[model samples]
Each structure stands twice: as C-alpha cells, then as structure tokens.
Target: MNFFHGQETLSVIEWILRSVVTFFFLLFAVKVMGSRAISQLRLLDFVMALMLGNIIAHPLSDHRIGLKGSVISTIVIIILYLFGIFLNLKWTWLRNTIETMPIPLIKEGDIIYKGLKKARISIDLLLAELRKEKIADVKKVALAMWESDGKISIFLDPQYEAITPSTYQLETELFDLPRTIIKEGKIDFQALKQINKEEGWLVNELKNHHQTELNRVLLATVDYKHNLNVFLY
Candidate 1:
C-alpha cells in the first residue's frame, strides 16, 4: 500500500515518520521566524501563528491531510513567512508599514486623550501598569509610553525621584540589591552567600525574629541596607 494512501488506522511507522517530519519543519520554521513568534507577539503575527498551527494540525491529529499534502502546505507557509521576515529585515518602509510604533499616552504628567483613543487602550489599564512600577502618583510621571508589545514604559519626573545624598554631595550607605534568604518555607543558602552572610548569622537572625524553625518562615530577605526582613507562615 502507498504510504500516503487513505487508511482508517495509522500504523506506528506512519505516525513516527509524519511526526518527525512535522516537528523538524516546525522547529526550523520557528528558528527562522525568530523569538517574535513566541515573544512580544503582535496581533497579526498571533493570528498567523494560529493559522499555521491549524494547517499543521490536520495531518498530525486528523487524517484529513495526508503526509505529502501536509508537508507541502507546511513548507509553503514557512517559505512565505521567511520571505516576510526577509522583507522586514531589508526594507525599513515595509517594516514600519507592517509593525506598530510606540504611542505616547502621557506627556508632562498629563494624559493625552487623543493618544489614548488612538492606542485603543483605556485609562484604567494604563494606570494599572504604572502602579506596577511603584508609581503611586501619576503627577510624578513625566512621560508614559505604550510600547509596541502593549506594555507601558513609565518615566518619572526627576523632582519626584528618590533623592540620593551623593547627588547633593552628602554621605549615604552603599547601595546593594536585596537577597532572598527564605521562600515558601525553605532556606536559601545561595542567597546567604550572595549577601556575604554566613548560615549561622541567618539562623541567629531567624531566632531573633522568633522564627527558630526555618520551615515556619514564609519569606525572608536581606534588604539593600542589610536589614533582614522576615515573614512568618
């Protein structure tokens, strides 16, 4: 019987061969398409991806498409995608024509109503993303932009920023990043090393906070000033 012959039941050999071919083709296609296929996916690209998946799914899941027909269709889609990628890279005009540019949502601490309407994003959603950046007051923001990926990028006014003693020529503690000491009832020895702290110091600190049992501690972190903050479970 022909390999591509209509059959109600799929043999192990047929399944294996078809799977390998489809998997490799998809892998190669994605690699060529770049991370944009998986990350920061624009709406058009997202729809195109769903269509490609539908095309490939017929042969793998349903027997509507035979191996030969599926492979050829898949190849055509991949090649067309590759040509689009080529155009995107080589032609600046084409790239701009296909992709959306960053839109300004806020300027000088004031919302640009026209821009908000053009972006098709609501004021509530914009404020939500700004709050995530630890911005309590919108007036403190100098500019807010809606990125191409639909995320907001906030720029704070210099006057509202945290004052550094050094900026005014005063003394200040050395800056450092916080390190997690414990998380989810588990001790993190690596974090202790990151803060240049010993396990004994960690144990004593835990005890000082009335948390002698590491398992009972929900979360702990060494702050920028080296102060240990413990959260109990």
Candidate 2:
C-alpha cells in the first residue's frame, strides 16, 4: 500500500514499485488507444498524448501524489479520445473541424504562398521536405499537398517521371518474393516446407552450388524458381 501511495517518506523499493506499476499501466493505456495513435498523431491523438503525459508525470515525481487519481483521469481521457474518434467517423462536420483537409502546397510547378501561410510553414521547410523526396527543383513537381499528419505528398510532373519497362512495352517477369530458408546459421523448417523442399535437398544444394556448410552460411533464401541464394558470416 505504501509502495503505491506513500506516507511522509517512501523507501527506494517503494519508489521502484511505483515506477514499474505506472510503466505497465501506461503501456495498457497506450494499447487501448490503438496503433493509429502511435503511427499517426492527429488532433485528437496529439491532445490525448499531451494530457496523459502531464497527468501521469506528476504522480511519478511526487510521492505525496497518489496513482489512483491519475489512473482514473487517464481512463476518462482515453474514453473521451475514443468517443472523439467515433464522433469524427459518424459526423462529417466534426471530422472536417478536427482533421483539417489537405492543403495544396504546390500546383502545376508553382508554389502556393497563400497555402504556405495557411499551413504555418516556411519556404525553407518546404524546400527541405522537397529535398527529402529527391525533388531538387520545385518546377518539376506537378502537385504537392500538405497532409493532415504533417507529411508532404509530392508528385512529379509527367515529363519529370522516371521511365519504366511499360514505357517501351517490354515484357517483365512476374513478382516473386524470396522466402528465407535459413537465418543465422539455422534452417527455417517452416519456410522450407512452404516451398515444398526438404532439409536434405537444401544441404545438398548448398554443398554442390556454393560449396558452403549449413552452419557457415549466415542467410539463405529461395525464390519461386527454386534459385538458392546464400550469404556467409
């Protein structure tokens, strides 16, 4: 009891206990929030994160502050956040109000200064984002949108796009992902079974083709054509 909510003074063990309990509780809270909150921070997620951090931080630092109130407050906030997400899905007006529409940062190779002002981003930041997308020249971009998640979506002009096999009407092989048959000098029996191969065949193939022992090989993958690729340690 003292470990959770201390009296006048807390022992080191009590402090550690409080930290461990709070850590796991926060993990459970985050799990309830879902993966979207971690992957992409929207308006609701941002607010929830800030509030939860602030509420939980005080109890961890001050022994006088009990964990019970913070836990209750976190649960209530999480419920409200989930409710907000549900409302956003049900009501179009609420969704539009909370999650702002994508603003056009660039149109027809021209920079939209008004859009930049509205997005509250500087020209240098825009250029930095463009550089990240390997787009050095702004004139090469057909359209660039400022996404709600604070990411820039850039599309190159048709003329600036890279040429592919389809451009010349060339035939191409079908996509075939390689399966890992062995990793870290150990065979993955499941992957071998999926490819309709046995352990003996893999050993023989490695010996005959690569002249390498199974334990010596770091990684081995087999493609759709049964082509064995091996990497050594």
Could you estimate the TM-score for every candidate?
Answer: 0.62, 0.91
lDDT of 1 by residue, 182-224 (tens): 9987778887787788877888887886656787888888886
Specify the poorest-scoring 10-residue window by lDDT in model 2: 1-10
Off by over 4 Å in 2: none
- C-alpha displacement of 142 in model 2, angstroms? 0.5
Off by over 4 Å in 1: 1-6, 11-21, 162-233
TM-score of 1: 0.62
The positional error of residue 211 in candidate 1, measured at the CA in angstroms, is 23
Q: Find the candidate with the highest lDDT and give its number.
A: 2
**Per-residue lDDT of 39 in model 1:** 85
Least well predicted 10-residue stretch by lDDT in candidate 1: 1-10
